[model samples]
Target: MLFFLRMRWHWIVVTTCAFLAIAGTYLLTAEPTFVASTQLVIFPQVSGSEAQRAFAEDAFIEGQLEIARSSDVVGGTVAALDLVHDPEFVDQTPSLQDRAKNWLTGFSSGNGANEVQAQTEEERLHDWATAKLLNMTGIRRIGSSTIIEVSAAASTPQKAVDIADTLARQYIQKNIAMKANAARQYSDWLSTFISEQQRGLADTASALASFTSNPRDQFKLAELQSATDARRSLYENTLNQLTETKQRITYSMSDATIVSPATLPLSKARPRSTLIAAFAAAVGLGAGLALAMIRHASDRRLVRPHQIAETGGLPFVTLLATAKRTRNGHPPRFLAVGTGSSTTARPVIPGMAELSATVVGLRRKRRVVIGVVAVEPGGGASTIACELAVLSSVSGAKTLLIDAAAQKSSLSKAIAPQSSSGLADVLDNGELIETAALPLSPTLKFLPLGRVDTVSPAIRLSSRRTQLSFVELKKEFDSVFVDISAFSASPDANAIAPELDGVLVVASHGRTSIDDAMRVIETLRNVGAEILGAIINHAPKSMQP
Candidate 1:
């Protein structure tokens, strides 16, 4: 419960953080991304020629479209735009190189390119251009037509448009250069072969004529004529091949053309602010819940009186959730609260009005011995012991709060700071118990912790004098509440608690650990202490500032 109260301050922090976190994500992920796109005819001219290629396949269209959208093409576009000079691209250049260089690098590297080193700045620039080009590149068959759609994205509308335009122009020019070179080479080769065949044909024809006209070569006329015919056939074939080559070059010239040009997009292509903000808010909420649960679980402190009750199988007799802390940091005031109902304010002593009640109850029942114990120190157990005495005494019962713990002096000082001697002094040094006992009110009295001049044994009670004093104090009084130390695996509470008519175990919620509370309870039970039940002091709840 204290953990829950502590989280009250967290709500404001969470709200502020969540809002800022979502806003920050929007700022990061949401950006103006202008996408420039254009439609290309895919030069449907050749696409129509392949009879086996169904219109449904759109294979050629898809292949070219993919190439248009490919990283190389986009990279080329980014390079043409000199995006390398952009610092963002520069910083990312190295990572781009790494991705292109390795197989798994694509998964690890964001841009899916090889890492760029300072020495290879140009290469990095090229890679960055490539990555952006790939991102901006979107290629698809134009509704099953040979046509294709091409796009590029940039921060500004003009940049997106310019990139798309540049890519289209550059790719077309490159294809032209390659095809023209091939065409020129073919034309030259065919022209050369045709020339060779023409020369051979002329020589064969001349030889055949000479053989036919000269008597000395009459036997060679038929063979020479056959040779001439073969050469003529070869020359005719070369001429035909040259005509076909020219026709192919003419056909390829117009096969691929950019029919529609790219235009700048008016808006950013990405960085959806609403979507990013929503995603961020969801992530923040989940993380906040996890963090809250983690912190609460780690705090290990007991949170409520009920936690103690459940841990020890004992009902909580009393609890003080928000008792005021002392100057020394322990609970200064005393509270006697019950279950279920919330305690809003600590009731003023009201001139021992409650003291009047406990006395009446005890007197009516003829109570004898009383024991005061705690699950742990710093739990205000001592404070409860002192207040109970004051109430009892004021109510007309001769009450004595015996300082049974030989270890410390907090009880005497806080309850009766001015008193110089107490039960310890009287028991250990034979100081007069009657003198040490202080008169706090007409009905209430105090027993101070004895003189510092005498050191008592750490373990046992002050002495037989204090023991006999307890016996004497109890004779006329309805109850003698012994303020004992927190439980140890010893027989002292055993010796004293059984003699008491009842025991009231004082414990503070959220201060005591479960193990400590259990050990104390078990020890008291072993001592055969009359199980008068438990009191959880300083109960769960936050204190007002």
Candidate 2:
């Protein structure tokens, strides 16, 4: 959360895009609607036709509502009325008028693939707008009021009015025309049948009159009467069917009753940008947190030495290493004792001071020569060697800090500016080792890793030199500290460990793997070297304190 809050720009960009997308959709996609409305009340027109009229009215009202959605109504309205020309509302054909005419004539039916071509320009346009514009809404009304309601929407106010009025007029005209046609057709058919029946009756009467003279058969008279009664029943049924069809058509088309006309709506309906932006921010925050957790999981680097100390229950002596630079940038972040400083990079911070004091407490003697070695060369062995010498000499006793690592010239570079002779010259060439030791303070002296040309490194730490140096050291120095190269990677520890009181292996925090440390321990053990204890060198502040 803190990291997210700090990255304000991320939130801003996400929220802005959300806001624009939502706001733009609303502005571009939303349509404004205007509605117009009028009312109608239905009542009986004839004294004898009251029941029929009521039935017609009821059915007609339902028909009108349904017709509003039919192709005839929508097509006719679009063809007759002028509306905005939008791509979604137009046919793909070049001839707009023909398209409109065909639509109005009920030639096109909107369907799959017919989405653009199935409808004429006018029909397509009207259908495209029907859900948005003209809606019969309902044939609803106030209680006890026979008024039927109508509603619609369009780009222009006048168009809304035109649609409402035209729809009502067309519906009424269609209904009246249907009722008139049905009545006329029924009346014509009835007249023709009545005339034919009259002619037949005359002939039958004449025949009967002739038969009566001969005293006609009784079964024939009965059969004639039955036929006459059947005809009458058939006539009645036909009359009823014709009447009902007409009444239904009339009721459906009537304009004498209306509930309300549709009117224009003042506002467009759709998206809220702020709401979208808020939701986007929430999603972005979640994404950021997930990313942070993933990064945290992927980091595979060792950090504190306490991880081993707590788990292994081993005491670690913190050592400072002489800082060196490899070809890699800034030497790895793992062991940062002091940067690029070949001099004394080691220091007695509070924790180390207390730790060193404790280490002295566990020892049996004050003049212990602790050889500082590590699993690797850059693990602050020289730094530990220097600081340990400082700490020992700081007690007002004579002390000598020796650099045992020959491959690296960090000590030579550091002490050459002050000392004229070095340990290498003394070991291999029998050069005077006493005059060149640098006095950093009253009791402390630093020996440079000096020139070695005559003798091999293996022989320098041999029992012969050990005896020679110890014999010389007892005369002037109370304690000596040997800083060796990585004994685990090189063979120096095995060669020199026998000459020293004990070997102190220095492992860097966050750099040396546990396997590497164990190997160094094993190597010292294999070499018959005395393992005094392990030292954690060049550790970060948090790891120390």
Candidate 3:
């Protein structure tokens, strides 16, 4: 995970920066909203302890909260503040949807519709204001308590405070009005009932007086007096109820009281800039890491040392760091190993010395002929072979470096560019190795690919004559390094690999895939080739000495 993070650090930084830019843009362009809240304490106004106990229930408190958020309360507040004309409640400018609707309907359609349209427009404006107020308003009961919280959000702190306070006031007034209306209705009903009772009492009293005037009707007079007394008592009770109901209408109280008035907000309620930016950064970083991991999983190129064995199951010979280019944009051809400079290329590479020593150990059997091959072109096989031969020759052994890769004779071009005959001529025309080979030093000799118009190295490399030539070269030189073509480029390496004493597989760092290297190794092993080890050449600076 850490490796991938380092490899794709720039991508992560870029993604995070892009998210931060979006957050900054929103912070700069988004409008700010302020919230103000008021609290109301609800209770019963009736003159009884039972009413108060019932009012303490959560249901009663919830009902009061609903009333505070109702359309009636919100609309009353809008009318009280004349919010229909206020831009915060109802925008004076028409929206694009409104304009489009008007265009589709054709505004100049009929006459005699002005007054009706004006009335409808006024009603619509009021409804819009009420709806807008309701949307911005929030009413909730505070826990299990009798207190209700009413909050309103607006563009300005003062507007938010006004809306919240006005809505609370309207709710209180509506409650008082409802109580007053109930009391007035009761008073009217009691007055009419009392008037009917008074008439009945008068008739009973009249009947009682008439019966007393008759001397012989004593039983009828007593019965009439009893009936009249009961009627008088009922009339007095109805009159008292009327008086109390009238008083209640004059002094009606609200069920809820303002315990906490709305106050002006100090900060915006939305668009938390810092938190938004932090969240965006986190999301972007995660996304970048996911992308990096995906890319890393798909990539098969070998970069580190452990991957050589883990991927291809091949023995790690050594890693050769790429040499820095000289002033002319070319790598130094042949700097000695013990030189003071670390910038130039050396003939004695990091692992080549050990490889040369291993080859020299094999020289006890008369002669050692080793071939350096690659899975693909540009794996620096020729460079490794040349360096190996140079190191061997420097160690006082008679070394012969052969450029048998006829397709790409890089060694021949670099060393024996002037030579006209090489292994190609030696294999085709029976030319001797000593005649075709050029002298690089007293101990080292070079064999170029020479002309190949008449001979193909892939077909001739595995021939009987080529095997005899190898035998003669082995008898003559103590060490022979053959540079074969890439296995992907031609069949020459496969044909020539088994004939050599041992073959070194060359793979380029960061360029050669582990699968390709493994395939080459498997092919060589199947062809009865004597495998020595492997070399990772042209490694990046991080893997350098």
Candidate 4:
């Protein structure tokens, strides 16, 4: 986790900051909404067998729930509370997006304007409140039971409570009204039916009287009397049904009961600030970590010492920190040895002592010419070469520093800037090493890259004279450090690598990639250059540099 943070802290920081800003803006600008809920227990009004009742109970209760959420019920509640003119419902503030949409669409003069003009102001306001109420209300069944929960949201606690309670009451009243209307309709139809039955019964009775008075046949009289009795019985039954229907219409009841009433809410239900902030933080952190992981996986820069060995397949040497220059704009005095010791302690350059000791160990018991070359430019190969030469000379070894880079000789520009003759003169003009080499101390000699007018350093270094000059230098100096051009920049390092005892590859920390280091190592090995080891320069403080 720490590695990921260090590698991609910028990505993490940017993403986390952006999410936090959005969360803060919402918290500050968004309006709070309060919710209040009421519950109802619906009863099945079906008249049937037990099996039929059980089958219809669920469907009946479900229909009641829909009725509770219906527009008629909501509109009735709106009218009861006069919410169309209530300040909480009528004077609500519009959001920025809503205002912008209104502004953009306000200029239209079309059928839409005519449609708005068709409705009266009161009707329009009532319809708007009904729609708004529907949007704010929620109704759902409680488990598998006959109870249902209805909730409403508003900008204030009291308003929310009023809406919920009023809506529930309105639904109950609507149920009562529907039952009353059905009973009344049935009562009117039954009264008409009874009137027809009564007239038919009177006709039958009159026919029986006529038959008796006229002394008809005995069989006809008996049949007429039986018919009169049957008609009278049916008419009395119809009259009783009409009387029962009139009683039902007078005392119609609702099928639903309020199990709970809405109470005034104490807190806002929406814009839950704490949960929102935490959720935002979690989402932001997750997004940041994801991006960090992706970036870390794609990056190939070598930031650790273990990566050097894994990529270049070379022994890991000491890590070097960036060397600081003095106020005079020259290399630090530590680059060269001091003559006298001071009373106060001086800061030691990181990695120099370890590197010098490593070089000495590699020398074994004979003269060793170690060429320092970087995989890429600006890898501090020249600085390493200079330090090694200075340290070796101070330690009583006959040390010689040579700048053999054909293109942009950093060592020549920094160390032997005053010297006019160097390796170029020795290799191309057959100048003696004694005349070309400049002295920095009693034991250290500096050879700069003199002017090469026409001949290329590669061709010159490949000649027999360059090889003989290097052999003579080896016989003269106990240790020689050469600053060769980067392998990517020129082929001078390859040309001079075979002549040296071994070559030290230098790669910059966090700048050189594994692939680039591997390619450099492979190219040097293919040319038969002895692979000594590798050094990592400009390492961060977390490492031992």
Candidate 5:
């Protein structure tokens, strides 16, 4: 999270904009909906046995809740509201393809067929309205209670209220009708059973009368009398049940009652602007964090001195700030060692003295020849080389600044643009090296690349004569600072690398990638060049370590 906040906070605005766009679109396109709800309480009927009633109550309430959401209740509500004819409830406009198809059907069909089709279409519309109403309705039991909530949502407050009230009323009427129908069915079955019992009772009574009249067999007469009594008792019990069932059919009412009627809603329930905007903002924040992390993970620029050291397997020197340009547009100078005066036009970098000390400590002998090179161009290698040479000269060492980079000698142009003879003239044309060397200060001497044609310096620097020249120059000067071309641009640095005492690689912060720096390190190691350490140049103040 901190990484995102510190390194990639800009992503937040992008994500916020995206989320705002989506929310704005929804606000403009979506219709506001209002919701109204009605509550109903179910009471247990008193007709059944105690155990039967307890189980029945639970099952009954559950069944009713399901029925509230069922197609029957929805269809009844649709019929009561005449939703089939309402444009808001049913989409009357057909698509172009559908209109064309309908036209073709009417054109090909006879009048009778068209009438049948019209009836079918009406039925389809009715079914569609019922389905649509069901989608807009919600039914649920309120916790562990017999009460059920029926809610409806629509585009208008009145429509929502009407649908909710009408649905509850229809459910109540349907429940009453079901109970009455059940009682009537039981009464009808009882009536048929009573008729059968009456016939049986009459037959048994007739048999008993015959037995009693004959009086020949007492046991048979007793058996016939007992059978008649049993039949009469059974018929009386059935008659009592039939009377009770008939009374129930006449008196039974619906088990459910409306506890709260739906009222017109005061406000729309959905698409609340405040809630939607807050939610969109939250989503935007999360998306921004995700994008920031992704970008941070994929970034390859080296920003710290330790990162370059760890990546290239080299020791870290010191961080150097990007130099200010002089009036002539030359790179700035480093702080001179032990110089209390700050009269130089170029700004003094803070860590250049430390960098010079570290380089000086790496020297095994008094006269040290250090070549400065970079992994890629624009790494501030020339500026760093010039600064180090100045610092060494100010420290009272006889320092010679050598411009070995042939293609673009930034150091040569900055220090000695008008010099007719330089390292390039000496190496390519066998000119005297002493004539090319120019003195910048009593202790500091400068050697530029001088004028040359298309030939690359890598070829001239690779010669045995140039190698011997470096040996002789190292003896003449206490310290020789060679500014070489970037390793990626040419192999001139590598060609003269073996002749130098050590090489200091300069990497620009946020410009040189770890992969490129590591490649330069590997190439130098392959040539057996002694690597002293790497210096990070042109680092931002915030990035200094």
Candidate 6:
């Protein structure tokens, strides 16, 4: 995670920007809504045992909640509030189908004249308003208690409050109406039953009276009196129940009561801008981190010293910081060295002095020849070779800088631009070696590749004549540094690799691939050349050691 965060930080910034854009768009275009709520308490009439009453109260509360959110209550509220004509309740934006239908209606002649068209439109509007009201209304019981909360949302605070209050009132009215209707039905039935009971009592009384007078059978007379008494008791009980039901209907008592009235909301309920922005930012950061990890996993560049050593199967040397080039038209300085006469110092190439020291320490003899090569082009091999030669000279050692690479003559152009003949002239053209080599400092000499367009033929010629020329040059110079082409580009470096004392491979951080570096090592090993530690060039400042 830390590696990805360090390497792929730009991806994080891009993902954050994308998230902010989407969140800003939603916040700007979304509609604001206000919510208002009212609380109601329900009380069931006690009529049975303790357990039965408790169960009945639970069932009653659940049933009331359902009724409160029912279509009947919502529909009544919509009609009472005249919401069919209200713009907030009705969707003013016409759909494509509605627009097409309106266009057709305007062009049609007989359809517009029909009376049913106007009635159908009114019915559609009413249905739409009822659905809208139901969608905005919410009803839920508060925990295990008999209290319920009713809430409604709308564009305006007043509308939200009005809808909540009206819903509660309509539910209470419906409940009362239902109970009163039931009571009225019971009272009517009881009145008819009472009339029949009174008629039966009169008949029983007449029979008893007649039986007593006749005195023909004592059992029949006692049976008639018992029948008359039972009829009278049933009549009295019916009379009492009928009277109570009538009183209840007159009073019209309801179980639901508004404990808290809905109040106007002070703020909007949805589209919390601050909270939404924070949540979006958090999501964006997480997504960015995930993307950075994926990118880091897929990258193939060798950015660390350990990676180069592990991949190339070689020892790791120090990293070299990238040097700044002069903007003005002057030759670039390689390494910083005191002039021994002035306090003002020239800019020294970073890491070159360290590289030269490493090479010196790795040598077993007093005088040694080291060839600097790279796996790929633009790896700063030539620059390091020149700087190492310069550092060796400043240390009072006779150093020879050879630009043997034929592809690019950058070092020759920078150091000995006036010299027209070099190593190639000495090997192929039979030119004098003393006349071809140019002297830069008192102890430093340079040999350019010398006007060679092709590298392979010149390397072959140098290989045949290398024993005589190289032995005499080694006798005069203390340390020899050869700058050659990239190993992958030509076989020139490999041809001369066996002639040098040791070979140093240069690799650029974040650009050189492990496969390329390994290939270069394998090529040098095939020729039985001595391999020194690798150097990382153009490395970041933090990676320098």
Candidate achieving the largest TM-score: 6
> Stretches of candidate 2 above 4 Å error?
1-350, 362-366, 428-431, 454-459, 463-468, 538-540
Q: Model 3 clash pairs?
A: none
Q: Supply the global lDDT for candidate 1.
A: 0.61
| By TM-score: ranked, best first | 6, 5, 3, 4, 1, 2
Give per-residue CA lDDT, model 6, range 147-215, as digits (tens): 999999998899899999999999999999889999999999999999999999999989898888888
Candidate 4 segments whose C-alpha is farther than 4 A from its true place: 1-34, 43-59, 74-136, 153-163, 197-252, 257-300, 303-353, 390-396, 403-468, 526-528, 540-545
Give model 3's TM-score versus the native structure.
0.70
Candidates' C-alpha lDDT: 0.61, 0.59, 0.79, 0.80, 0.80, 0.80
lDDT of 4 by residue, 10-52 (tens): 8888888889889999988998899999999888877789889
* Candidate 2 structure quality by residue, lDDT tens digits, 1-545: 44323433354456556656665666567665455655555543433377786676666655655655565665565556543254434534458887676565555544543455544444555666554434422335435345565555455566557777776665556556756776678767766776676666666666666665776688887676666666556666666765675565455445454445555545422234456556655665566556645644453323445544554445554433324445632322112222443323344443556545654654336456667787887776665566566666665667887766776646555545445567766664544665657666667677777666754353466657432364466467877777776765567777788777777777776577766776677767777877776777655453344
Candidate 5, residue 93: the lDDT equals 81
Winner of 1 and 6 under lDDT: 6
TM-score of each: 0.63, 0.49, 0.70, 0.69, 0.70, 0.76
Clashing pairs in 4: none
lDDT for 68 in candidate 3 is: 75
lDDT at position 90, candidate 3? 82
Candidate 1 vs 5: which has more TM-score = 5
